[model samples]
Target: MKLFADYHTHTIYSHGTGTIMDNVNAAKKKGLKEIAITDHGLRHFTYGVKREKLKRMREEIDEINENNKDFKVLLGLECNIISSDGQIDLDDEAMKYMDIVLLGYHMMVRLKGVPSYVHIYGRHYLSKISKSMAEETRQSNTDIMINAIKKYKVNIITHPGARISMDTGRLAEAAAKTGTALEINSKSNIMTVDYLKVAAGHGAKFVINSDAHKPEDVGNFRNAIKLAEMAGLTSHQIINAVKS
Candidate 1:
């Protein structure tokens, strides 16, 4: 299956190895029509892009895309799903610069309030905890993402069931209901056959992305395609693969 766009790549802004222009150039070389530089949110402790940095990032994107009409380089964020209430760091001001918003659970986000504390820190020993507690935490995380989709115009949910505990089936259904696409990421291990099977059964549309941190890795969707094939996913089911 061929990909038309990759809207979930990273650059030096968020611990990535390449620059914004480097990612765009790589996408051009690979014949992709579009790409987005989705840095981590400001709440991420170690590698998050600061709030002020987003304006400069948008400037760079505008400059690059102005001269390079053949490829579109979008400005976006891989926003952290911070609270069980589905409160992320994305705000109205930030949305002005974003063409796509990718949501995922990350361990390094600054946790505040009881909901964030429980899901971000409390989910570590899910297996060791009581069965009821584990189930509660899982449902909470799942609802967080579900509510995130409803609360925000999220384009994709990256790497579902990767590092956090969640009920993937329910998450998939919520995403589908909200017109959000579930991602088949190149780097995350959660895009397994069974995960795709469950998601697809819920009628979730999918987007395949490299999740590339380096320029060279930019349009590489080998792993994503393999998983899709394993789950018997048609190219039509993949949003990014569709001809516009």
Candidate 2:
């Protein structure tokens, strides 16, 4: 398979095992034209990259670009979605330094104090919450997703699955209107065939990502390709950063 770009990647700067050079080398080995360093944004309690760390990573990328002419590294941030209440941890100034901004729904940090449990299993597996709380969480996630697209003009929404709650169809419409690609992450098996069918029906463009937290995972686009095939995606329906 021809791998053009792997935009969702993590480095040691984001509390991962991979380094900036490790990722770039892996991508070159995989014959990719470009790759992005999209580590978790600041405010993630467990493993997020701070602004200073991001700057350092950017410098490393610049150095690599100056020395190597084979691949391009785009600096990016996987900004965590704070809540369905329209809260985000990253600001515009922070966004200005990034080439791409990706929004993901994870429970590492919840501003509403709804407990970190909401993130581990997402709204789908919560058996202990009251109906009201569940509904609130769901609404909050939907609102956050919509607002993230409107607020940042984000390049893509990363992995809106696994532990997140939102109407896929509605979110797809918002993505289409905002020009934000909805990512099909290979890290988790959350973007089910049915979900892809729904999103594709709404004319949402899909971007494939490795979501590689380690060097070994970089450029492994197998699962994403299978899911896209299951979704009946045509070549024109998928977005390739190099081709774009």
Highest TM-score: which candidate?
Answer: 1
Alpha-carbon runs more than 4 Å astray in model 2: 110-128, 131-136, 241-244
lDDT string for model 1 (126-210, tens) is 6446776777777877887888889989988888888887899999899889989998998877767998998899999999999
lDDT agreement with native, every candidate? 0.86, 0.78
Clashing pairs in 2: 84-140, 84-141
Root-mean-square deviation of each candidate, in angstroms? Answer: 1.7, 3.2
Span of ten consecutive residues with least summed lDDT in model 2? 115-124
Q: How many clashing pairs per prediction, in order?
A: 0, 2
Instruction: List pairs with backbone clashes in candidate 1.
Output: none
Report the lDDT of model 2 for residue 28. 88
Model 1 off-target regions past 4 Å?
Answer: 126-132
Question: How many Å off is the CA of 51 in candidate 2?
Answer: 1.9
What TM-score does structure 1 among the candidates reach? 0.94
Evaluate residue 11 in candidate 1 and report its C-alpha lDDT on the 0 to 100 scale: 92
Candidate 2 differs from the real structure by a C-alpha RMSD in angstroms, to one decimal, of 3.2
